[model samples]
Target: MSCSECGSPTIDFSLPERYRASLSTDAAVANCCTRCLTVEPVTDADTDASTPEFGRISDAVPTDQEQAIPLLLALELADSLATNRDAIESLLRDVERAGADPLLAIDRLARDPDLEPRVDLERRSHQIEQLLYYSNN
Candidate 1:
């Protein structure tokens, strides 16, 4: 499903079993947009019983790895840079344009021999790796 706010694709996830018992049929499943991060419940018609996989809803979502990598990079950069919204958006656009693999880029930045002694590159790189690991699993 697509996000109403940004028109970006969404990841569908089922509610936990404990919470599911309390929800009505209409609220059993929910989807969160990959880009905008808007979350809303899926309607009965949108629900599919055939796919019942639990946890890590992203696995079920068909995402473009090329696009996802840049988006993930943007999020990590924004957090690490602690920049304003406009600056974050600009950085995201730049990363998207560069189309470089985020993991490799972050690793390279972390290991740059002549890098300025400002923010902790190694810490940021580790956080990004953890973020990717947790999100995928």
Candidate 2:
């Protein structure tokens, strides 16, 4: 089955009951992909949940700063990862040294079409945010 978010073909059989309860009868067994669900996680609302949606800062119409939200999230994820730890950490220090706000930096990128993270990175960051939402709930 295809993931509701990324449209990947991977499947996740071990969806928690809360997640499963959120699905409709038509797609109880095959809904979102593993990478976009269990591995990366995704919004239940994106998969057709009747529950009220909440906590999506980017849900409002995309703005200059809103668009950069993904890159900021990706950088945060990179900061947490072992491989990109040093580079992203150094970059974070540079951001601090320059007296730059990361959100402002992202907003600048969003305003500049040519300077943004590639589409793939943006999508991954959004997906990660979705996963984070599920975890928080």
Candidate 3:
């Protein structure tokens, strides 16, 4: 079956033994495409009887720098929008799916001396939180 997130047909249900225990069913294999699995781990709750083996993506924890980097970049980009409320809203959802700590990432971004204008980091961070919360709800 195709992956739920990216719809790629290359599904490898028999993931390495490491990822197997985390998953329950052969049918409910984490979507084959590494990109989908990499984005977030699939949890039991995300699976069910009817849907294709690939189910909802969970806020799987980021294990290392490679995993964390994309989330960090997504959080940073979320802060600066050039209009397009729709895109902003979409990006907010993507950031939420990323499952990174918005507050921490925003604070770090704000504190960066490299950032040209470092004004109102806290407020911007709060805005990001609000977007995440509101989007999720």
Candidate 4:
């Protein structure tokens, strides 16, 4: 998995699920170094569901972490939504400014490539979006 353009050497990685969906589907992903990014089909994603497959014969995939993403996000959003939209916008601006440093922590996990977060940020985002936009009347 070397850099395709530079041939600067590369390695296989078990990337996070958040990155899996962000690619090919979201515009925000355009900012990253796309050349090195690896996007797997949903069925082949190295998610929690992919793990226990080695122990069983069935093909059912496991669900994402139950509460990790939703709790933090809900808490944060509760705070944000409590404030005026302008205040929330300003908080987002501050977050954007603070997050410019792409987390290199992922690079450090080259050895433990299978590590996945407990909160399932990808699934949580989807749930939150549904809760916010789709009324269950």
| Candidates' C-alpha lDDT | 0.46, 0.35, 0.40, 0.27
TM-score of each: 0.31, 0.26, 0.33, 0.21
Give the residue spans of candidate 2 off by over 4 A.
1-82, 114-116, 119-137
Ranking by TM-score: 3, 1, 2, 4
- The lDDT, on a scale of 0 to 1, for candidate 1 is 0.46
- Which window of 10 residues has the lowest lDDT sum in candidate 2? 52-61
lDDT of 4 by residue, 1-137 (tens): 23334333222223334433323343211111122222222332332332211111111111121221112122233323434333323323332344421112122222223423232434444343444345362
By TM-score, how accurate is candidate 2?
Answer: 0.26
When summed lDDT is taken over every stretch of 10 residues in candidate 1, the lowest stretch is 53-62
lDDT of 1 by residue, 21-66 (tens): 2222346665555544344567756566334332222332224433
**Superposing all C-alpha atoms, what RMSD in Å does each candidate have to the true structure?**
14.0, 16.3, 13.4, 14.9
Candidate 3 off by > 4 Å: 1-82, 117-121, 135-137
Residue 93 of candidate 3: its Cα lDDT?
Answer: 48
Best by lDDT: 1
Give the deviation of candidate 3 from the true structure as CA RMSD: 13.4
lDDT of 3 by residue, 13-80 (tens): 32333223223233333433323332223445444323323222222324332333343323324436
